[model samples]
Target: MLGKLKDLLFSASEADARAADHDDVAVAAAAVMVETATLDGTFDEDERASILGLLQRRFQLSDADARELLAEAEAEQQDTNELYAFTRAIKDHFDHDQRVEMVEMLWEVVYADGVAHDFETNLMRRVCGLLYVEDAESGAARKRVLDRLGLSS
Candidate 1:
């Protein structure tokens, strides 16, 4: 009976580890989005809504879940010392095109308030490089976002 109990405990510990890993991925992704939004030094309401909407749509999460995740992400981002903790998880989990899409989404957030800041642009460039997205692709994505926002180059 003791041996069986030990095995059960081991199995539960493995499950907990897996859950932690999954949470890490979700938190990392959320952190990336949150950090990108804060890059402009103006986390405006429109940008927040855009980020929440994207999270809800992408993760198939309800509004409450998305908000909770965003809150958790904000905390994690504040605690982290660098961007790699978030970018690495995204690079490992997402494909090239998906990363490009992420860049596009970030640009959308930057433009959501009807103004694009230099810091936001710089952050997007750095993030694109980290995500292994080519410069041309990143540029193209930015252009597409700008076009959608009806913003002139």
Candidate 2:
């Protein structure tokens, strides 16, 4: 059992390292946002713009750069299955607060349409666990996003 776990972590770590370059990081992060936006099978303009805005602000990228990253991520997401790849990339680079912020950005995307779907919520839970964020921290991140959007839940 321990050997299996070690092998899994080692593989994940190796994959993470391979995708650790700057552009790859942006693509990986944007892929996560893409996953969140498409969770409900209803990806829309609002969600797309929300993701663009988050990437712009979080990474301080220009509009073109953000759009480029978004396009790459959209393509990458279509080919990707599980989010473990993205989360592993994130876990290798981003610290606790950054992961918490990723959760918050995900919540913003989930609520961009003014309603949270069941799949969106479930994806957030799973991503938070993968990112090693505590439930309380993710809850706090959700609250912060809700407050920013003048929403309550």
Candidate 3:
């Protein structure tokens, strides 16, 4: 798992290097969102829509582009059972504010179905830990998301 992540995150191979130049940030963000949406036993329509909307708004992509990114992210998420590499990549690529925004995006996905399952919460904790986002910052991000969505925490 670590090896695979290292390669994906840091490899200088031609293909990966090209991909890294293209939109590593988008791929990494989409991958994390995909993982969150699927962490629970099911990936319902609500979760799917939530992720699509988040992707569109965060990345400023058109519906078609966002859908494409979502599809790519889903495929990548399925290939890995561990998120350490993705989170690590995100940590290395994103600044502190961007990481906090990611946490907010995650919270949005978690509450999209009108519920936050244990597995989903656990995944958020792990992702934040790997990103080196402080607990207080993550908690604040969650709260902001919940309040914006009018959901109680």
Highest lDDT against the true fold, candidate: 2
**Candidate 3 Cα errors over 4 Å, as ranges:** 1-19
Best by TM-score: 2
Task: Give Cα distance to truth, residue 62, candidate 1, Å.
Answer: 0.7
| Deviation from native of the Cα of residue 95 in model 1, angstroms | 1.6
lDDT of 2 at 66: 95
lDDT of 3 by residue, 1-153 (tens): 999988876766767776664477788788999899888888899989999999889878899999999999888889987688678778887889988999999999999898899999999999989888899999999899889989887
Ranking by lDDT: 2, 3, 1
* lDDT against the true structure, each candidate: 0.83, 0.90, 0.87
TM-score of each prediction = 0.83, 0.86, 0.84
TM-score comparison, 1 vs 2, better candidate: 2
TM-score of 3: 0.84
Instruction: State the local distance difference test value for candidate 3.
Output: 0.87
Q: Which model is ahead, 2 or 3, in terms of lDDT? A: 2
Please, what are the lDDT tens digits per residue for candidate 1 over residues 9-105? Answer: 9999999987787677677878877887787677888988988888887778899999999899999999985898788887887778888887787
Number of clashes in every candidate structure? 0, 0, 0
What value does the lDDT take at residue 101 in candidate 2?
87
Record all residue pairs in model 2 with backbone atoms less than 3 Å apart, i.e. clashing.
none
Candidate 1's TM-score:
0.83
